[model samples]
Target: MTESPAHTLFSFGTLMDERVQTALFGRAVPTSPASLAGYTTRPLQITDPAVIAASGLDVHLILERRLGASVEGAVLHLTDRELAAADAYEVDDYTRRRVVLTSGESTWAYLDAKPLRPAERIVVVGDSIAYGRCDPQGGWAARLAAAHIAGNEARRRVFNLAIPGSTLADVSEQTPALLPARRPDTLLVAAGINDSAVPVGAGDGDVRPDPAHVDAGLDSLAATALRHGARLVVAGPTWLDEDRTRDYEGLRFTRARALALRASLRCWCEANHIDYLDMWEPLRGNGGLLADGLHPTAEGHRELYRHVRAVSC
Candidate 1:
């Protein structure tokens, strides 16, 4: 009989590899998504021949202390014996340290044996589009995050905080809470479609969000990001297939309204000296890119990802 795995290990590096885990523990350990805040990763060159062969790499990720940053990884459950095996596998350039995960779980991890500094972080906040919606791949934001995972030397951490059915007002209310904990180098606000949507059967009273309030919300978000040393980029409203979108979840979207909002948001971004991503033009006349007339399909998300990657770079 074997005792239940009692040790908790958080890994933001090669220990995440199934091959590495099997070599050390004789099996792949159980793990769950988790993140460590106030830390980042840098490349650590490996000289140990055994580690190089075991992990199939001559370089590995090493943690570095950085304020206003976080590293995404997983929490691995291991028995005491397996934990010891992991310790033996790590080289002198790595040091084991007990740390608290963002979920408040206390776990042991291998951090940089030597101290250093540096990094870039991106945070995306918006509506369902930014939240990925119909896309099974988790949309453009997830693609951006995947691009930076593990082996990528340009490693940029992207955090998507968008929610379905969110509006500028909702983002304005939620974004402030992200501060003091996450100070992203770039902040992407991908919203306004919901704001432009007019409620069905409401006649003339069914109006798009007031330009004044929209401007105020944008200004507030920009100020918040700027104060925290982040560059703000606003992704304007996308084009809608009005023919298929006139009735959506008790609301109605029109081509004219979407176009108006896009133009208004673009002008505001320009006047405010903020970067604006013109999501409307590329998506217009392409109803196939939209699912159910609103949210993007998988191919549509890839299209969106290309535009986002351009500005982010």
Candidate 2:
């Protein structure tokens, strides 16, 4: 029998993000907002940070439509070796299931489902970094994906939906519809700096610190992930240098607050059975790790992958 040609992988998450696409695929991908029917999208909880998902609630199968919608994403035409490499990057907590895409024809695609654990799908949601900013290959979310794939060959798939400037309030607002659609396995949440920096309180236009709001948002995200048989991983914010002296009303980016915020997130993760990754401490020492003051460099990504590999091993 003649061998069939390799199939193309359609994505709608972090892989869709520009930088991440370039890093993993060695170039940009052509994409559109493809929607899968009988599913919904949700905010993913990954310790201290949030991601997004497209899950199915009522049915086991997810029917997708490549509507040519102008969403950001890419199409990767894979060879067996490339597929293997991709699989190596998505092994943990995910299984490669083929789905029928709604492009007026049936197309095989990969879906990340954790049947053994029966956990919620893993979603990585947040701001720019979550969106695979500056250092495409080095973003924590991508690193996590690559690590998971390498460790759990048969079951690792993650959907990363990190928008720039996304906040806790945004997550709270977007979660309901997304959860049922994505049916996530876990949620990885990393957001806050923007919220903290925005001015919105009664005072001399001062920035506010509403840990309660942040906590509530996280709680909801966790609950949603758990509801869909998913776990949670909350990652705290990485260090950023927003001039505190400028007294930027509503935006507070200070080292002290960052540490405290991370602690609070860690406490929440522990109590909720969510995994926690401390990006702040690990990425601090060398300037080599950060592309700018905020994002991770290629070396930084490698370091993160090493840590994740260690954990899995």
Candidate 3:
């Protein structure tokens, strides 16, 4: 009779949440902050209350383990049944593999890739959504981690460094620090909404679309991603409501500005050979999915995840 592999799951994303951990594993395992070599974290942009833009340019990767530095996360010791359940739930964009984990011990951990495409390095940079915002259950990026694990049982290490309210400019400034550390296989970037929301000049009316800035940021981000031999995935900003009422806080922008930003982003993605995920139309087209006019409620997030899964698949 064949024996089931005894495995330990190392999680760095939303799985770090105690409740989420318990729900997935049926019991909580001891968790600590751990870092993987050759990866950095950043933010994902979100506009509406319910939906967030998968913005920014922060992602985790495999590299040489540093002496002192470590990424933060929890480790779950898994039973065969629990591991099976986890595998079923995460069978999407991720695949599992073996990695020399933070504990300095080698055990069976879920790495996020098929055959674990070995890269000298890789980076994912974005805003709050990338960082995982209000969705306490660990946001989309966390889910992506799980998917990576389930998909590639051979290599399950992807670094996540998503921060909230991060702009493209922030990515440009930080890319150098991350690129210097490791060479990545894939670089995914999500940005835009914040640029649209920022008030223009001294007065509110001065707020306008800065195509020049957006263009410059994209150029730098794409060059950096390609320089690292990474495939770039650029996600457009999620949809937001322009009309504000006593019920919700909405960005007040003209239709022209909104359309222009969308067009500009689409154009840039196309020109750069970056894989673009258009989250705006799907979220806006579906009303019940959004909790408040902006962010994705639980249901909305699920929808967004579905979208990512489809594209990733």
Candidate number of the best TM-score: 1
CA lDDT, every prediction?
A: 0.77, 0.54, 0.56
Candidate closer to the true structure by lDDT (higher is better), 2 or 3? 3
**Residue 226 of model 2, lDDT score:** 47
List model 1 lDDT by residue over 186-302, tens digit each: 678998888887779766453445889789889889877755645567888877787787576898877777777787788888686566778776677899999988778998889
Q: For model 2, state the Cα shift of residue 32 in Å.
A: 49
The number of the candidate with the highest lDDT is: 1
Cα displacement (Å) at residue 239, model 1: 1.6
Better of 2 and 3 by TM-score: 3
How many pairs in model 3 have backbone atoms within 3 A of each other, for residues 3 or more apart or on separate chains, i.e. clashes? 69
TM-score of each: 0.60, 0.52, 0.55
Q: Order the numbered candidates by lDDT, best leading.
A: 1, 3, 2
State the local distance difference test value for candidate 1: 0.77
Reference-based lDDT, residue 49, model 3: 25
Winner on TM-score (1 vs 3)? 1
User: In candidate 3, what are the lDDT values of residues 1-313, reduced to their tens digit?
Assistant: 6344366666665455566556666566555555443333332232332111111213323222222344555566666877676665442334443344444643334343322233222356777656556577666666766666565555444566655677789877786577656445556676666666633322355344788999998888876654543455677776655542112134333334555677788887766535567767667756566544555666666667677766653
lDDT of 2 by residue, 19-119 (tens): 65455555564455554332333333332111222121112222121222222223556556556655554424333543333442233344434221222
Candidate number that wins on lDDT, 1 or 3: 1
